[model samples]
Target: MDILVCVKRVPDTSTNEIEVNDAGTDIERDDLVYSINEWDNYAVEEALQIVDRVGGSVTVAAVGDDESDEVLRRAMAMGVENAMLLSGDAFAGLDGRGVATVLQAAAKTKGIDLILTGAQADDGCAQVGGMLAAMLDQPFASLVNMIEVESDKTLKIGREVEGGEQEISRIELPCVLSIQTGINEPRYVGVRGIRKVASVEIPTMDAAALGLTAEALAPQVERLDYFTPEVGAGAEMLEGSTEEMVAKLIEMLQAKGGMK
Candidate 1:
């Protein structure tokens, strides 16, 4: 059950505001702290958990520049067998599809049997898993919560859907699965563990190494414009007793066509 897990470094915005950069096409990342995207951590951990059960290795990969190695080291520290950096200056400003393009090239060299990724990046464009599946011409399932790799080279998986229901299926291996969180609790890496692997080098492959050219890797989608929204007035507070509030609410609703 050799696994390849793809992770991304996303801004840790839980404690910080995401400010649009002066260029407006993206955020100001220079001063922001980055961490493995929350869902992707689950993907990494899920891969580790699977291989731990069936006896195999988990290779982690990421698409980014040199600064991207932080998350890869963290994944290795969590006990991944190896890490690869799919990087190039040409990869800058690429969209999710472009990222998938590079990742597919790198993945081909790794001899992966199972591929895992978060259902969606925390930064929120959920396009990579499906796109990569298409690029590799492999079967894909998204939002999977449970997995059972069978002896016959197929997997029985349970996918999460709305209203707490689950969809189950049996799919062949060499498939792509976009993992959903709560599938498993990600492990915690102590500072010592991180530091122990801190100096370990992760091999990187640039676009050329992956047989990619600048033209083949350009973003298919273009960002036309970006703007910071003007601050608006605060909401009106309805005051008084419950009855008064209900009456006021009814009046407003009637005025707004929400009620007759």
Candidate 2:
């Protein structure tokens, strides 16, 4: 199967009370905890299960600084065969397109047959998987919730569509898929598993090694600023006891034509 799963390390939203930085360009990161992106966990687990059945290797890759090694190692602790860190000065401040370009290069070198990524990262930009596929000139599918390998070269995939429906299609090998969560329950990585791979080395690839120039890695979109949206003034609070509040809520809904 020779699957490559792309993962990311993001702020642990559950633990961190995210606040805007003084500069308003990004979140306040100091003293914040980081972990694998929740959606990426599902993607990695799906890749592992696929390899377990089809007999091949599952490699997890991340685009970040050395600190990202933690997430990669965690993926290793979850039974991934190999991990690679795509990192370098040039990779810094890259946007979604640049990231896809880096992964496209890595995919070529690894002789990968299938590439999997989370439907979206913490950034909520669900563009990488499709962009990587386009850059590689391979078939692509997003929001993939089910995958059934029909043969060495073909796969039957199920995707979620509008109206809460599932769309099933056959996609050939050498393709990329953005895996949706709930596809599988990701396995837990305990302290023992983390310690087991603690000493294992993970390879790192830089822009130069990937034949990428600084200009090539440059981000097209620039963020001018980051500010919290102004709170809008709107509704009235319902008062009185529970029954009265319920009645008031129904009255408002009916007044707004929200109820029959």
Candidate 3:
């Protein structure tokens, strides 16, 4: 089995550098530090585990600018056999559909037998995996917590559904899966692996290489501006007797429209 795990480089949410610009349409990446999207690390780990058990190869793929190579190398250092970067100036400003189009083309070139991705990227759009699956015309399952490869052609999986219920699904191979973060704990790169793949070059592909054009990959949805939400101080507490405090709390809630 050839497992292709899609990864992404995103601004570290903890850095507090992700902010909307004055226009309120897109995040400003200036002065931001980048890391592999946290959830995608779990997906990569899951792929590595599968290949370890099943005697296959794992390839990590990403769509981004030249800077994305660092994240791909990180995955390679963690034991991925190959890393691919689908990037170009034309790929800039792509939305989910454009991303899926490029990724689908790349996956086809790799002759992938299985596709895995984080249920959602931490930028939090939460739509790429499903969109990619749709573009590939493959069956897909989301929120997967556990996966069992029954054979070269089948998978038995466990997913979490609403109301805390666990659903078991038997999906065919050549499908896509969006793994939930808690599906497995991602492992750290060891010194040996890190040093071994540190200088490994990540192969790059572009829209033109994939026989795609900018118009075809252009975003259906456009970002018009970027802005952050306004911040304000918390409410003042009124010190009083228990009964009086309750009355005051109700008054505050009512004033804030929390109470009808």
Best by TM-score: 2
Residue range 147-249, candidate 3, lDDT tens digits: 9999988999999999999999999988999989888888887778767877877789988799898788979987665566678998787898999999999
Candidate 3: how large is its RMSD?
A: 2.9
TM-score of 2: 0.94
lDDT digits (tens) for residues 96-134 of candidate 1: 889899889988997789899899985577889999999
Worst 10 residues of 1 by lDDT: 25-34
User: How many residue pairs clash per model?
Assistant: 0, 0, 7
Error of 3 at 77 (Å): 0.9
Using lDDT as the measure, what is the rank order of every candidate, best first?
A: 2, 1, 3
In TM-score terms, candidate 3 sits at 0.88
The 0-to-1 C-alpha lDDT of every candidate, in the order given, reads 0.89, 0.94, 0.88
Per-residue error at 220 for model 2, in Å? 0.8
Q: Distance from true position, residue 5, model 3, in Å?
A: 0.7
Backbone clashes, candidate 3: 7
- State the number of backbone clashes in model 2: 0
